[model samples]
Target: MSEPFPTIRRPADRTQMILLFIVLTAGLAAGLAIYSSATSFITFIRTASSALFLPILLSLVLTFLLEPVVSFFERTTGKRTGSIFIVYILCAMLLYLLMQFIIPQWQSAWNSLQADLPRYIKGMTNYIRDLGLKIEAQTPFIDSADLVERGRSLGKDIVNTVIVGTPQSALRLGGLFLMVPLFTFFFLRDGSRILRSCISLAPNRTFEMVHDLSYLITKQLSHFIRGRIIEATIIGIVIFIGLSFTDIRYTGFLAVFAGVTNLIPYIGPLIGMIPGILVALVDLGIGGQFWWIVIVYFLIAQVIIDNFILIPILISRYSNLHPLWVIIAIILGGNAYGILGMVIGVPIVSTLKIIFIEIRQYRRTFSLSERLPESES
Candidate 1:
């Protein structure tokens, strides 16, 4: 009996196969070139859109945070506009209090730090010198004086850079603060209608899938943002209360900094503690008990409280992503868009994961349906 399928044996068949291979290789090269161009174009577009639409983007984020409250108020009042106005009033009062109390305190602390910069630098130099002396005792080649000088120069450079950058940063922030509220108002008012309109654009074949996907993604994003805000607030309050017991200068500012930085997973808490440690070293000396206190407190608050308690309850349940993947996402995000990228990376990755799972399930269902007729026949 002959084999059901014969291997290629003819010269012409071999020539045809070789030609097919060459064609495929050329087509693949062309496809890769096109993909590369598309990627570059997408990057350029993203950069432009980020710059142009930052306020709108921020407003959308704010809408996500405040929408539930708005809806609750709307349910009670039976008026969306009235609910939004009420929320706006409440926000204004909160902002006023922040301006009256927190901003001044933070500004005063900042000013004090600036006024005492020279002293901090001198203290830091002395700390480095003392530490370097011990090292020098162990290693004769170590130069305490050089170490002290380098530390002093680094301290001065950091202060100078911060001083130089503040005005530009403030101006940009002021613009954002002004624009975000206006955009947020519109988004809060029309968000549902907008979402419905977008969903309506999907074809009937995929309409149900699109609708479900949209709801799932939106719910996930809203939960993530609100949970993060709550987590940051809790962390900030805890840090502030903890630091208030110690003689740390700028306790509130440091607490706020820690809370904000806590948004970036893994590395954020570490960075948040830098200013606190530097401040402690300046105020209480390098070898003081307060140094240990600050370090221990940060470790407990950030690593233990955040990683073990808050994250598990607030974020992990919703995302259900692995720690390794989270770290990888943070690294990629940090590389791509700096701090903003780091803040958003995990959520973006989680969204992608959801889409992938949904797609896989869809394909499996499709395949099973196709196989049913064949199996029956």
Candidate 2:
């Protein structure tokens, strides 16, 4: 028994230790390099300012979103390329319809609001005065004269910015206008090929792992895209029908604005409401019959869509990602590449998660047991 109590020694696999160290060092170096690159002001500006990439990203997003439809076509037609062509044709038709029908109506609505700015501003001033009186009555000694003045100033700024400053701002907006669709087209066409080329470069042993990870990334992206588009379409249609039934002018335009704005998470509905409510105010004036009803309609529509429709159908289908992580990713992405980074942050992080999980699972599955000493046995 004493002889059998031999020393328990740790394995001295120098190669594995060295490899691990090398890998860790390489990873650290790569991370630092990326951080440095991202933090560079010039790089950030260049990426943010580039109009060319936006369209490609949009196209890729649309492609990912429509990939399931494309897959269905592929399965039916037995041709991936043909399905891709069909998807593009569909996209082109949608864009053409927007340009032909939607944009003109939106422009007319915007122009009508711009033309009636003075009346809206006057109504806003009276509303502020009424609110001030209510506040004064509630607090007795406190006067809301300063608050009313501030509200008036803000209203004036809003009107001036919209009517006067819009032309100058259009220059900046034009960048996004050109970039999104341009980037979207190429991204859709070459996205799969790019993924394939990337996977092919991985080490042979890791090839299967990479392939699996890639598939997972595609699946998640596809789900997110499809879910979001479906949710948006449903919301848009519902809002349009509701507005139409309620006799709200520019219902189609408002609905489209809401649908498009809904693409942005958390803040989108609020953003969409800004233009819609503002336009409604201009159209109906302050004391008009439609004013309160329209406001109530918007509030109810938003509540129902956000809670019952959007959350239930779209976001609930995905894994519950931590809000904290999502915020961090957005901030980091915004700093790294501005709007594009912000747009792609969640998807990129999700893809990375897939890769990490795949690697971890691979290790767990492939792990071998160590041999024990004979004496110990």
Candidate 3:
């Protein structure tokens, strides 16, 4: 009996290989199907989420950004709701004062811009035409009559966009902004309970993991928001100060544009810098020493401060996102939601990544973790 050889089991390993092959084949099929339907899914999601997207997103971000302030006030007043109200009142007053100063200056700059837009457009087009072999010569294939008609149509559009678009956009934004205070109020007042109620839908077995993920994401996301505000504020103030030292017209306007554009992540600097450069080119023409010096100094100083100082201090370690991913996110966000998308994309992606990592870690720690009911859990 002791000498008898034990049976070697080859079926177990073979069965596992077969099962893996089936699973991989199924996954490939599912992936292909998903790729095929991606456009429709995106359209459905975009349409469905468009209505309350900004409102909800803004509210959540404000709530997170203001959390530390709220907590500090809470420690003083010993009441969460009262602290939220206090923060809101302070915010409201600040916004009112800021808007009063900004709106009038912006209006003057806008009117001035409307008067100069056609000249800028003409100069830019001439500059474009000068760049032979660079633009692929689409203008030559097109008839002069067609070009003139298109130019007129474009000019009208430009005028309308500048004159009509700005105020209309501001009004639309104002209306959207009106919802923030109300949403922020209720959210700050009862956000924790609301979040908990949502999380309570998960099964008991996975409650800890879900809760931990939420906490990790919330903390990081809030930090990201605060860092952005601080970074934008610093850059804006610095730009304004630098531009004030220049002979450039509309320094206030240019500085404001620069700062506001900073909210759009990597693409923001180029956008913000363009108006100043254009104005300089139009004002001083090409090869003006003053224009070159001012633009170069302004851009370099801002870049040095932001990349070396503000970003390293505020975002790099805290955000824990790769530069490549940040760029990708900005592109995707811009494509999906324009400027606002670029602004919020990093935080959203960071939050999602943190959640995924936490879930993965939990599963890796326990071999049988996947045995639990995923949906119920």
What are the lDDT figures for the candidates, one per model? 0.80, 0.68, 0.75
The list of candidate 2 runs beyond 4 A from truth reads 1-53, 75-82, 94-104, 140-145, 160-185, 278-300, 303-306, 317-377
2 or 3, greater by lDDT: 3
Clashing pairs in 2: 54-180, 55-179, 55-180, 55-182, 55-183, 55-184, 56-183, 56-184, 59-184
Ranking by TM-score: 1, 3, 2
What TM-score would you give candidate 2 relative to the actual structure? 0.65
TM-scores of all models? 0.74, 0.65, 0.72
Better of 1 and 2 by TM-score: 1
Please give, for residues 1-377, the per-residue lDDT of candidate 3 as tens digits.
Answer: 47888778766688899999999999999999998799889888878787679888888878878888999999999999899888888988998999898889877877887788888777655554555434446556643443444555676777677777777888868977788778888888899999999889989998887887787667766777778778877887777777666666777777767777776556677778877776777776766545653555355546587888888888746346767887888888889887778877776777677666656655676756655567466
Cα lDDT for residue 124, model 1?
A: 74
lDDT agreement of model 1 with the native: 0.80
Best by lDDT: 1
- What is the C-alpha lDDT profile of model 1 across 285-366, one tens digit per residue? 6565576557555676877787788888887464556778889988898897776678778767876776666667666887
> What C-alpha root-mean-square deviation, in Å, does candidate 2 show against the real structure?
12.5
Candidate 2 per-residue C-alpha lDDT over 1-377 given as tens digits, one digit per residue, 9 for 90 to 100: 35777688989699989999999999999999988987896677776556445555565666667667777888899877787778778878988987897787778877876877767677767777788888888998874567678778888887887777788668756865666555555555577788899999999998997897678656766766667677777777877776675545767767877777665555556666665566566566555535654554465566766666676767533333456766776788789776557756655665565556556655565463233354368
